[model samples]
Target: MSRVPFYLLVGVLLVAGIAVTIYRHVAFEVPWVPGEQRQVWEVEAQVNFIAEGESAKVNLALPSNQEGFRILTENTGSSGFGLSFLDDDKGRRAQWATREAKGSQQLYYSVQLLVAPNAAQPRVEPPPPDQDVSWARPYDTAAKEVIDQAYRRSSDAFTFSRELARAFSGDRQDENARLLLTQFDRPTLLVKLLNQAGVSARKIHGLLLEDGRRRQSLTTWIQVFDADNDWVIINPTSGEQGRPDNLLLWEAGDQAALEVQGGRDSKVTFSMLQHNEPASVAVRNQLANDTLLNFSIHSLPLEEQSLFKTILLIPIGALVVVLLRVLIGIKTSGTFMPVLIALAFIQTTLFTGLAGFLLVVAVGLVIRNYLSYLNLLLVARVSAVIITVIAIISIFSVVAYRMGLNAGLTITFFPMIILSWTIERMSILWEEEGPKEVLIQGGGSLLTAVLAYLAMNNPWIRHITFNFLGVQLILMAFILLLGNYTGYRLLELRRFKPITED
Candidate 1:
């Protein structure tokens, strides 16, 4: 074989692995380290209303154009009612309907949001003209006076809105603000005052998120459009200029946060809980919604994902076997047998696995030695060995259970067919090469299996192999490189040591 083509293939594998790993880490935001956790908030909204005997309908506003957070999952809990989501120029809303309702009804909308700094931002639009800003009687005069006072000290829309907010925030409130305050709350009043001065603004409702909070209501804030056609959030109470990190915008625009038809006394209350989740979990959840990436492992059902998590570690064990057998000249009964044994070890811990393996194989060898006297055909003899192996496992498992050795029950995790084959190979080795050679190969197999178990069971290795698909390519490259190596094994180098000593 041309070494050039071989080297080129290895180079391609290495490069491709590294490039893909980097891409997944950067593009998909998959973490490099295991057990890294990100803070996530689970926010649930409870919509309660009293419906009469007639048909009833409810519309609840939902969060959209989130900042500093991404919604990973959203679901509703509305039993016995028809539910549908509506999106329009107004905003996103969830509507529920039921005919002939006669009692208090409750509906739920819950969302899991991942905290991320680079979360998507809403498009910037100039604020719509205020069509409903007119105030009646003395309140109309008071609003005009308040807007004129703030406009005189400010240059643009943002500063004008800030000045108006500042005017009513502190102890030395403007007389006009005090008069307006009697008729309107601070946020609603600010929106009216800003619009009266020809500065585009509106009142937005948001939730102040805190860990483990329940039954919290919305906090109203002023949203003003700046000269650049971007929405600038202002704290109407504190006169703050930007949105706070803890604030979640739940409702915007000039629409009611909730509306109920054929129902009365309707209200929505929010409950939120915050916790940490592994970065891999967050990536899985975030990507689960993307249709194009549905073919990836993260998109699999949870049961299949968990199965693949274990399955992906097999390559690591195979790499360990290749290194032990090819580079260290370790002898084993079968080439990939150590890998299967290592997988069992993962399920049954190191010391317990070692004990169970020895007990099974030692007893199996004795049984095979006796069966050989029957002179059975090869296929029938191997079939007998498999049945014998299963019988041994069952007997041992029951005995262990009776004795309360729960760990021993895990011995069943060992592959039965593989164990039978191993016994068959070892028996043939014993007959052909004698007991001494059999011991060497059997001991080598156990040692290789132990080493492979250590590699496959490592937390970092398991995490990387599961999260990064590129690692499989890297492992394949390494196994191929080891396969091509014809150099002296580490044990063989001992022969050269004697020559150098002389």
Candidate 2:
């Protein structure tokens, strides 16, 4: 057979597996090990206001796809107040309504977010028409002076925003910036200047997430729509262009952060705490929001996930079987019987599975020797052996229960049909090739099963096979390569060694 097509197929499988594995790791930030943990922030917002004792309503801005954070869950707390979430052209908002409320009313909103290092940035939209700004007297002339100076130095919307901010920042400030700062806040003034210069700009609010922080207020930053319609964040005082990792945007649109009707002196404060959770949870949550995850194991229910966690390890056991039988010349009763036995060993611990297997096979051989006197047909003989094996397992289970040996209960995990076939094969071997050859093959099967169990039960191997689906393809490629190997086995090489005659 031509080896060209076979090697080409192997190469294709290998490359595909590697591409998928790398993309998942880099895109999702999925860890290579199960023990890796990710940081999470639990932030709580407190809205406090004095009520005028009438029907009260409060609306508060909610967090959305801000860069570097994935919202896991959000909840609102207010007694006797109905809460509902609204999504519109602006952004997400939570509104609380009550028929009647009195002095010192408080509403709470809590959000739990996972810190994702590779999270996609907040969505950007096309720039809206610039808001018309009319400044009075000297301020109009001063704003134009700053705008003209920034426009000369900038090439695009982003650079223009940077230059505009730089004109009013730190040591670069001149009379125009100081004059504008005297009346309007830095963020508002920057927004006005950018809008007057034909740039769509808005004031954005965010909270600085500090561990165990309490009673914090939102910080104002300017958001400018650049030439490509992408949103650019600029610090009004420092001329910085991007959001810091710790800044969590609370409001990104032109809408108000908090609005209260039938109430006065409305204000909102925030508190947050930092903690850690398994990174698998973050990946699972992130994938849950993606349509592509419908085919992933993470989308399955908990019970199915647990079941597949063991099922995925079967290929690893098969790989071990191929390596041992094909590469090392190990002989067993059946081709894949050792792999099945290794799976049983996972449910029943190694030592317990070994002892139970040896006991059943030893006792089963004795019964088969007696059945040979009847001269039964092959099918009937195999059927009788299966029934006998089941009976032995039942009797042993009852005996162990009475004797208070719980480990004996797991003996039922062994596959009855496989055990029957193994007993039949060993019996025929003994009758045809003698007991010496039977011991050789039976011991070899046991050794193969033990080695396979160690491989399948390994923590790292189990994690890799379950978390990365591409690993199965890689294993299949290796198995195909092993199948195509025509060289001498390790054991065969010793038997065929060249003799050095004296």
Best by lDDT: 2
Question: Which predicted model would earn the best TM-score?
Answer: 2
Question: Candidate 2, 295: how far from true, in Å?
Answer: 3.6
lDDT of 1 by residue, 1-502 (tens): 5799998999899888888877777656778889999999999999999888899989899987477887788999998889999998767899999887878989999999888776657785667657777778888887777777878988888888888899997884977888888888888878777776777888888999999999999988888986677878999888889999999988886678999998899999999999999988887887335444222578778899889989999899888888888898989889999999999999999999999999999999999999999999999999999999999999999999999999999999999999999999999999999999999999999999999899999989988888888888888889889999999999889889989999
Candidate 1 residue runs with Cα over 4 Å from true position? 1-38, 48-53, 72-80, 101-107, 122-164, 167-201, 212-214, 225-230, 275-296, 370-381, 398-406, 481-486
Worst 10 residues of 2 by lDDT: 287-296
lDDT of each: 0.87, 0.89
**TM-score of every model?**
0.81, 0.91
Which residue pairs clash within candidate 2? none
> How far is 399's C-alpha from truth in model 1 (Å)?
4.3
